[model samples]
Target: MKPAIALPLLGLAPLLGASDLLVKALGIALVALPLLSLFGLLLPVLRRALSGHALWFGALLLAGVLVGLAQLLMQAFAFELHRALGPFLALLALPCLLLVAIEPAGPGAGLRQGLLFAACALLLGALRELLGHASLLAHGEWLGLGALHWQAAADGLPLFASAPGGLILLGLLLALVRLKP
Candidate 1:
């Protein structure tokens, strides 16, 4: 629920909305999805280290630090992506903080939530980038794999880049997911 609102809001970069397929392919999709998963992995540690309300407050701070570290790592290793993603990376800690504040520590709950989060982020990112930009996979050189570059022309609807458009797209997607087999 949090991510359904959060993912499209944060993923509005030109890199994501590139008109080229290769650029979209090598964009932040790799880094962005796993960061949430890593936060999930860290949640238990944060919970164990800080009991009571301290865990709630401390987890937010810790998640910010973790996201910052990830930003630094991306800057050091993948400078182009770090530059491309820019301030958007700061948004990654949001779900982590929310998760820590709201969810109880249950067996495999974090895992389930993390996987769902990753899947949703990936799907939302793809939809927002593809439909909004009129491109599928774009920019492989950012990942240092130039050989994988590819792009097809797309006229593209302009609205998917906008929040209202994303909300509509998300609504339709949610409806599709809820349909019974």
Candidate 2:
């Protein structure tokens, strides 16, 4: 994402917490990203149609409406996941707005972000669930992926189950990814 978006994504957080929620994290990334990009695509047009003051107000209204629509969709398609996602879904609007603030050079931009996030989400979710919960895809049933999960007979590291531990695990993962070849 452009700096416009990255700044907000980093700040709104709980995106990191999504790792703890597994299925809910996947649901948001799969469902919300496209809607965000679609709304984002229209930002330039809306910005052009309205002046400075109206632009801010219009964007806010649009963001709210979009968020509502996203929530409704979540409620409809992923009711359980939506409930699990809780208010964190509201924070998604920040990324949507930031993504739209800067024009994309091509259609692939959103796809790139979505795919990368999805992959990271998968890795983080799996890692957290494995070490933190001693299970892989523990809530897979919540997303109709029951076959994908299996609980272990042994216990896991309880620390990874918490938010701060997710951050630590994430930092460790980042370091691993950034290691020089």
Task: Give each prediction's root-mean-square deviation over alpha carbons.
Answer: 4.8, 3.0
Question: For each candidate, how many residue pairs have backbone atoms clashing (under 3 Å)?
Answer: 9, 0
What is the alpha-carbon lDDT for the whole of candidate 1?
0.60
* Pairs with backbone N, CA or C atoms under 3 Å apart (clashes), candidate 2: none
Off by over 4 Å in 2: 1-12, 51-56, 100-107, 176-181
lDDT of 2 by residue, 1-181 (tens): 3465346345236467676756756776775567556665666677678866787688778877888888898899878888887887776666555555555545555455555566676777778888888887666777899898778999989898788888888779777977999
lDDT of 2 at 139: 69
Worst 10 residues of 1 by lDDT: 13-22
- lDDT assessment of candidate 2: 0.70
The candidate that wins on lDDT is 2
Q: How much lDDT does each candidate structure score?
A: 0.60, 0.70
Candidate 1 ranges beyond 4 A from true positions: 1-29, 32-34, 105-107, 145-150
* Best prediction by TM-score: 2
Q: Could you tell me how far off, in angstroms, the CA of residue 112 lies in candidate 2 after the best superposition?
A: 2.9
TM-score, candidate 1, is 0.70
